[model samples]
Target chain A: MKRRSNSDGKSVKAGRRGTAARKRRPLPTAARKRRHLRTAVRRRTASVGRRERRDQRLARELDDITEQQRATSAVLRLIGGSSGDLQPVFASILASAVRLCDAHTGVINRWDGEALQLIATHNMPPAYVELRKRSPYRPDQHSASGRMLATRAPIHIADLAADKTYLGGNPPTVAAVELAGVRTALAVPMWTEGKLVGSFTVGRLEVRPFTDKQMEIVQDFAAQAVIAVENTRLLTELRQRTDELRRSVGALQRERSNRLMNLEAMAAAISHEVRQPLASIAANCSAALRFLAHDPPNIEEVRAGLNRTVNDSHRASQVFDNIRALFGKADQGRQAVDLNGLARGVLDGLRGEIEDRGIIVELASAPDLPPIIGHRGQLQEVLINLVRNAIEAMDLMTDGRRTLKVRTERSAADKVSVTIEDSGPGIDPSQIKGIFEPFVTTKARGMGLGLALCRMIVERHAGQLSASPAQPRGSIFRVVLPAGRNAATDATG
Target chain B: MNGQPEPQPIVFVIDDDSALREALSSLFRSVGLQAKAFASTSEFLQMNLPEAPTCLVLDVRLPGLSGLDFQSELAKANIDIPIVFMTGHGDIPMTVRAMKAGAVEFLPKPFRDQDMLDAVQAGLDRDRSRRKNASDAAKLKATYDTLTAREQEVMRLVTAGLMNKQIAGKLGVSEITVKVHRGNAMRKMGAKSLAELVRMADALGVRRTMS
Candidate 1:
């Protein structure tokens, strides 16, 4: 029993020691729970702050993207308004790309079917501009812009220096980017009418690669740039078509007016040349009957009547030949002719009739009158008609105080003028302006074609003919002609 | 018809047209009259009139002076020739002006040959009486020249109804001498009696002045 009691005492002693060990080693659940709660709160707060920052950044980025889209759209609208010159549109696209992408430089490179030409650049150095001008890069296997054009896809370079796939090896564009402290770059094809016409490239100075969001923004702007180019092309095409139509319409109007003037001139020539000879014939016939009634018939008087009839018949034949010449289907023949000489010849031929009618004809010429280049026969016809009309107007003066003054002078640097003034009953003021029109005459027996035919002949020679009432009485007709080269040289001396 | 030779009629033709003038000369010759044509009044003025029977066929409008002016000139000269005026296209005023000037006939141009000839004949007949009277007056004057002044006084007294014895008492002569002067004067003057002598004197217009 004493042994069982000693064992019990030892058990108590061991139990006591075990209780002392339990006290010495307390339970760690509270500290562990506290440590676990503190860790969980710290992790949750950090997660929430990160989420807020991300949302704010996304909102700001979205606003930036919206602003960029609006700016690009506005630039495209401005390009559309400017009717098709590609310079302004290219400038706006390049400048907007630089601003929107926050890049150091931006360039719009045009692939003109054979070569890649830098059309527009924003934020590029002057030295780069000079370098690019000297060594123009062509679109080939060695060009960065060329690959983007050939593939018609987007290209990105995080570090141009480190990148292995740079097609254009250190060209001016790449060099310019390097000088601008740009490492990351993006290139997108610019399309027009579903064809890759050019490329839009954005470069950054730092090694911050373009995110998907930034790439999307750039692509949207690239799309807007392409639309602007296409709009400009259609505008250019419309402008060309309008110009062609205007030219055609103008030519048609000229043809119609020419035809009308020709028809009028033809009719006038026919009537004036035909009726005068017929008048002379009828008068001679009447005078012949009077001579036959003499008691001892005057043979001389009878002979005079017969001679007059024969002369008139010959004159009628000449008029017919002139008509044939006018109507013949022959091309106009151009020649150099002395206008002063022609005027003198016509005046000399008409001098006899003028003297018989008691009219005074005076000719005044410039010291060195110019020769005109034209059809000689046509010019003669014009001068003769004008001179004859002047003579006829003075026919009724009984006291024989009629004067026809023909004067010539140089009018302009390359033009010469001839003026014929007559002292007779002047053209009526109301009829002066329209005298060149057909069928307008003030003569009692006149066919009213003299002036109309004169206008046509003058116009055919590339000259102008016009008439005005003379100072006191009668009319003055002025003709202006382009002087020939020889004539001008002679005139200078 | 009265034992006298038929009077030769003279025709004066005037026309402006030379052809019509020759044609008219031929036409007048075919009718057996002495026809003379003058171009104008000036030509006709220098011409002498025939003593037989003369008729003027003058154009209305002559070169120097008009036909109406010529007619007036003829009247002023106391010419007793009858006029037959011709016209080309006569207006009423011209015709009336010609007829009032004692034209025997006014013939328009292009007239029938018969019409012209008849008009000429009528003018010549009227001119014949005037010429005969003028010639008779000249013959009376020649016969009277041979007589004394006493015989003319006796003729004037007898035609004035004074008897022969009264004429002898007024002139202090014997009745037989007065009767002898009257008988010689009447016979020399180609009068058959005293009344016949008075008739001749009246026809000569001597009796009007004597009375």
Candidate 2:
């Protein structure tokens, strides 16, 4: 009975130990559950942070695209507003380039065939403005502006301290740019009509390289600058031509008015000179018939009155015949006329009138003065009218010093000149301006058509007539005729 | 066969231009006629002469009045002067108006000497006969006034182709008294015969309407 009681007690103790181990495993399971909860929270927080970072990146990219588009639109607006005045157009271009590229300075240099003149500048120093006035940079020379102009392309000088073209040159421009703290510069040529007219440049003072966006804005500015330069030159040429045409029209209007006033004055003078002699002839004939009827007939007294009446009637007829020759119907025919012999005939016709007025006429002409081709009667009329006028002009002078000198000379080019000079009161300076206009005369009771008719005859012969004040109180008239094709030339030059 | 003297008619000249007057006076003298020239009509009127036969040579234009006006004035004054008109550059209307005014002749200036002489001669002959007829009428009027109203009636009947007995019965007078009054009237009128007495009454434009 004692061995059965000891085995039951050992079985109870082993069951107790198994119960303790089961309780320890419940504690570890709770700890593992807490660790799994912490891992789930950590994964949720990491996903939220990654989504916020992606949203911020997308926003940044959209802002950069808008900024680039704004710059491109600003450059287009500048080019649209420019009209041909190149100085203003280029200045705006330089300003627009500086603002678009966000650079420190910009300039446009013009090539005037001998020098590079600073046409326009923006944000540049005063020293650079003054140096550009006298600077001459040839196209083949080693210069950033020159390289851009010669190749008609864009040139970039990055890191001015490392550039070889900037070394060992006495150029004031290089030293100026270096002192301005510019580290990068770009130049683009302005071309118009297939020729390089100038160059445009942009610079950065803080040693930064130009981005592609900045280069594109500068290239667009250069293209607009070229167009503006071409328009301005064409506008200047058009204005000059317009000015020349206006001056020519003004001169033609003045000439037309002068011709109209001359014609009216000539008609008034012709009517007044022909009426005086006709009235005296009618009165003398009525008195002669009364004397012949007396008883112790006075025949001798009647005969004397009859003879006087006949002479006055003949004098009136000659005045009308001279007037008819001037304005008769036209019958133009060409013939060869002796110049010297015609001159002598005109002098002889007026010899009596000249001597009665006490005018000493001196005639000097070359013996072999060539025969001229003209109408004989018209030419004689011109010579006689001129000689008669000269003799009459000296009629008021009582002194024996009155003279008329007529001369003919042959020029070296086979032209002929006939000059008539008179020692009368010289023509007034104001009257000489219109001396050839009809009815512009100084003589009392003088019809002023003589000189005008003379000029018309001279012009018809393809010659020229001019007048000037002669030396020492007189006037001179010169007539020039072109040589005939068959006339001999003066060989003894 | 009486030895009585014939009256000479005076010639009157009127002109405006002195030269034309001197010319016309010489022309009139060469024709054996006496002419007195006056510069105007007023000058000729101031020299009033007797009521004799006078011939007037008048210019068409004058300073104060024209020749036609003077001719009408003379007719209104009963002067009985015959006129010959002269002109220089006379138009056709002026010539027609002058002729209608009883002008004897119209002469244009620069005229022939014979034309003036012929015109003046015709004018003088007409004026002399007219003046003689006027004087004879005045004398008959004087004698008729002296013989009373019966003599005028007798003279009128005698020139009317009536017998003395018909004339006495019409005048209510005796035949012997009618013959005596007729003889006195014929003697005053300077008529030599009954035919002359009839011509004198006809020239005076006297008419008797027998009722």
Task: Write model 1 residue lDDT over A1-493, tens digit each, in one string.
Answer: 1112121233455466467535533337898687669858966986797578557656765677577768877786787587667777767777776776667778777667876677777777777666766776675654566577778888888887676444345575467555565678898988866777777888887776776656766787778777876787777788899999999999999768766866765654554434444434443444445446656665565576567667766866876676666545323455677777888998998789688767777888787876777767767777877887787667533453689998889899888888999887777798687777654432212222356666776775567898988977888999998889733343333
Sum up the clashes in candidate 2. 0
Chain A TM-scores, all candidates?
0.57, 0.53
Please, what is the whole-model Cα lDDT of each candidate in the order they appear?
A: 0.70, 0.66
Candidate 1: the clashing residue pairs are: A142-A167, A292-B19, A293-B18, A293-B19, A293-B20, A294-B18, A294-B19
lDDT of 2 at A444: 16
Q: Which residue segments of model 1 deviate by more than 4 Å? A: A1-58, A83-88, A163-170, A275-321, A331-493, B1-211
Docking class of 2: incorrect
DockQ of 2: 0.01
lDDT of 1 at B66: 59
Model 1 global lDDT (CA atoms, 0 to 1): 0.70
